[model samples]
Target chain A: MMTTKNGSWKIRYILLLIALPVLALLFSLCVGRYVVSVPDVFRSILSRFNENIEVSKLAYITIWNVRLPRILLAFVVGSALSCAGLLFQSIFRNPLATPDTLGVAGGSSFGAVLSILLGFSLIPLQLVSFGFGCLAVFLTILAAKGKNQSMSTIILSGIIMGSLFSALVSLVKFTADQEQQLPSITYWLMGSLQSATYSSLLIGLIPIAVSIIILFLLRWRLNLLMLSEEESCSSGVNMPRLRMVAILCATVATASSISMCGQVGWVGLIVPHMCRMVFGNDHRHLIPACVSFGGTFLIIVDTLARSISAAELPISILTAIIGAPFFIFLMRRKGGWNL
Target chain B: MKLEIKNASFAYKNGRTLYENVNFSVESGEMISILGPNGAGKTTLLRATMGLLNWKSGGSLLDGDNIADMPASKLWSKIAYVPQAHNRGGSYTVLQSVLLGMTNQIGLFSTPKEKDIRFAEETLDRLHILHLKDRLCNEISGGELQMTMIARSLVSHAGILILDEPESNLDFKNQMIVLDTLTKLSSEGIGVLFNTHYPEHALRRSTKAILIDNGKVQFGATPSIITEKNIESAFGVKAYIGQFETEHNMIANVIPVGLTKDEEKTEANEEDSDVLATLSIICSKFEESERINAILHEFNDILFGRMGMPHRKRNLYLISVNLDGSKERIKMLAHQLSVLPDVSCKVTYAKEEES
Candidate 1:
């Protein structure tokens, strides 16, 4: 009886499977002036996969090299931010909490921008940016760790650390030579994957991949964290240790994304809540949903940023414009302010 | 298994001592209620038992093993806790929230199996609230929310259930439901330690009671041991203990003097000389003995000289006095009145109700 009842409920999973491709295709096609037909895109992908008749080199390059990289980067970055956000929200057990809200992104932005203007091109500027990102997060964690491990204390530390790095970033921006360094630093701060090289993608890839893998593995622990500390403790979780590990994983993922992409906002803060609103807050459903949705959502957003103007707009500006209104809508729909 | 606390003391970081030097024990299958006032640390004691707090001093044990030394995961299998429902204001569905109870068993990639789902469903069914299985947690009524939390605790299947104010947010109907469930869980050999402000709930749900006040264990015993003195000590107020027969069992109501409005106002009115003058004048119309008996009847069972009244046994007597200075004196007065031969006395005295 149990088996039949449980087995009969396979339609939801099947629907998710069915919807995934349709969403992916729609996301892929929505970007760029050269509107490639779905069939043509599919044929191109299929021929490339099957090693069939030689396809147009321009179509392959445009689809595979230009559009696909940008789309995949958006997806990967979005997934990283949202996953990190979900992890932070559950760990802190607060909806207002997110991975970037802790100033990890701001710190990384300072590091990346500093490396950019200072002309420290050695060791791949991405490494320098990621290093500074890790440093800022480490300092914030240290500040928050002094007292009893309370959620409020950690949030306060994040705010303090975020402000400090932000001040430093402003300082660096103020003194920079206007001709050479200003535009580059501004572009970096505004945040675009336009400069997304296969090399740069590889640099961002390690941390995002590692962080997502860790989050997926600790999904059960993340769910447990939503319970009261007492309940979590009694449930056999080495809660403090698990919490530290989760927070570290989230920090690394967020910091790495920030270093590579340069301050992509709201995806970390808003996407998880959106994911939870649609899929229930079970981490099993929540984690995967956030990853896929975040990736798709960001891909669409970046596509819009690139295609809407004669010149490509910075992705961060577009994200804030779209994301802020959507976030407010989510907040209203959730009716969280009433509480 | 036995849960033991050997001189446990708890204080917040601000040096606000909640409970200090408290010692108590609970055997397997026993249901105990820890009763206290708002700031008296009933919740803190529960937190200590669950090893959720860094105790200022002293120790807690689960079946002779020191809880502080035990890892949280290992300790969890032995004890499951349901905190007050109000704290869980997250945007989680009832089923999803309850399924979180299987955190120890389920892995990240792994889906919930038929057994886990069945266990969760059964727990909800046992609480008779299976209809709310798919509802968002925030959308549910507070009573149903409390029931869902209980169901979540049940799914953990721990040897012990520690509930901190499980009845606080619940209405009377849900409170009764929880008491019934706790009683059943206890009967099934799960030791239950619940903190409650309601004396009646303690009497209904618990085989034993631990009265906490002033950051200490004031009294720990069976419901029978929860006398007027104990109530007064735990919450500095005199209570009117009324034992009444019910369809299923005997019901004991410990209505404190200042807590019940109708009772407290009448006590205040009795002291008025103007009312006394009017009563004196009316009494003069009847014979002295008949007037005395009539005057006694006019006053609700809270006053003196009640010999026979419907629902009141012929052995009834009433003791009314103003409580001065402290609860200890009022308790002494009530004790003296109760000991009077062939009389079931009611003591009514003015005292502040400790919220």
Candidate 2:
């Protein structure tokens, strides 16, 4: 009954959501330390599918082994955090909500720190980190439960849990050996995609992908969650169930991401805000927008993280440096946003 | 569908009882207005009725099923509730916001389909808000947002609608649009129950009125429920309930005079008896004459004789009827006729007997 008022504009934006991430992925592949030319990267990728093309080993090794896994890792972590951030914002009905709102990152980082201090293997470290992340959110809910289930109370509990985990991480750091274990623990806490091997990626990608896909499937009902409490309940949708599902998914996504790549903070808050500014709050538009833009943003940031110096800089610093100014500019231009 | 509250009682969590032994039923084609003073549990009553808040003892029944035990999707598909116009989902456009009412019918994984969108647009168009379909709800005016909310509720095509002060804070024109829309919807066989701050709106539009006053809930025909004594008792204000003559009808208007500090109450008149009267009517339009005839037909049992004539050149109609009914019925019939447009009516009562 209603025609799309700006049909071309809508299509152009959709194209951008898809195209930006692909471009970022390509950029990440072509701009690393031992760089391959754009055509060589394309040709090397094509050679695997087509036998007629000649393959270059340097291009193949650089693209497939080192940069490709890292790039995919950026996309996975970025998309997962962004979707989780958006879901948390909707569930709390507050724009300030993010992936770490429940302290999953802090708890999981503590898990990694404990693993590193105890001299665990890479696989056990990731598993321990993921387990602690889930535990953090469970503790947050337990703390906030039966207090009328108001959102602010849960958020306050999340903050308390987050601080508690951070304190534990600090306690571990104070007692850790300063020679070897301390540096690795500190490096992991700063967040980097340098250790993104295929096996690690495979272990982390399961929870992130499953949660993101489930969040995407339930995108339409998310708008209902943004409504006031009584309004949402009377909408005939099972709001508490929806809220629990969203919180659980976001928890899994955030925990898996933190376990894999330390604490990638700004992407969760910034990317979802950018997507909301561009696409408004219809989760139908916001979910896909958050995934694509979130992935692309981290891909771009991670590319810059590795290339800006002889030594890789911490990801959190660059993300804040790059994301804060951009977010402030967008917020100022739009005046502000509402839930 | 009929929504019935039977022996429903409600109390706050602090053990303060809001209301007790409340009973009312609204069916298709009926408009029921809920009136009460501030903090008199008007909102609580509505929330409890919709099962948003639990009733302290008794529960609401939709048709036959217990509402408290019903699943949300099953319950909402039959009843639509429009809350205060200021809602939290302002980031959505008008069309999308209205389409939210279709969430129950929509599948868990799917977006709104073409048919659902069409229905949403049609409901907006029916409310004359199709022009603002793509506009964000926050970018629109308060009245426009209220209308959008109403459009959302209507899009569900529910058998019953409940609104919380749908016309409050709206401009005069928006008020008319909202009140008129409710009237038209009820005429088309949708039960409408709304909370209102205006007793006059209840008198003008609703067939049934409920007043929650002094911890008591009263329900009856609109005219009887909104009398002067009831208004004073409910709102703690001495107000005059008088009729104003408009071109089409006599409209009941409530004018509050001053606040009452004393606990004294006015007693309702006990005078009740049959009366003999002759009613005279005049109309300039044929439609007016027909409306008069329809009103007069309701009191057909009291009529002993009737005569009518049409003056062709002057295009006027004159009718006279001799009536024998209770004093209230005759006054009510005359009051009803005097309210219609292009008609003038008067009733003259017969003298008392010497016995």
TM-score list, all predictions: 0.80, 0.92
- What tens-digit string does per-residue lDDT give for candidate 2 at B275-321? 78998788877645776788788889889899999987889999989
**Per-residue lDDT of candidate 2, residues A238-312 (tens digit):** 887889999999999999998988998789888888887767788888888988999998999999999989899
i-RMSD per candidate, Å = 4.7, 2.6
> Candidate 2 local accuracy as lDDT?
0.86
Candidate 1, A1-339: lDDT as tens digits: 112224444567446734763477456754577777666676667777788756677666778778776776787788888899888888888777877767787788888778877887623667877777788878888888865768888888889998999999988899898998888899888888876667778778888898788777777567777776665665665778888888888888888787777778788877888877766667766777777878877887888888898798998888889989998898887766321
Worst 10 residues of 1 chain B by lDDT: B274-283
lDDT of each: 0.71, 0.86
- Error of model 1, residue B331, in angstroms: 18
Model 1 CA deviation exceeding 4 Å by range: A1-57, A334-339, B10-21, B54-57, B107-109, B213-216, B247-249, B258-355
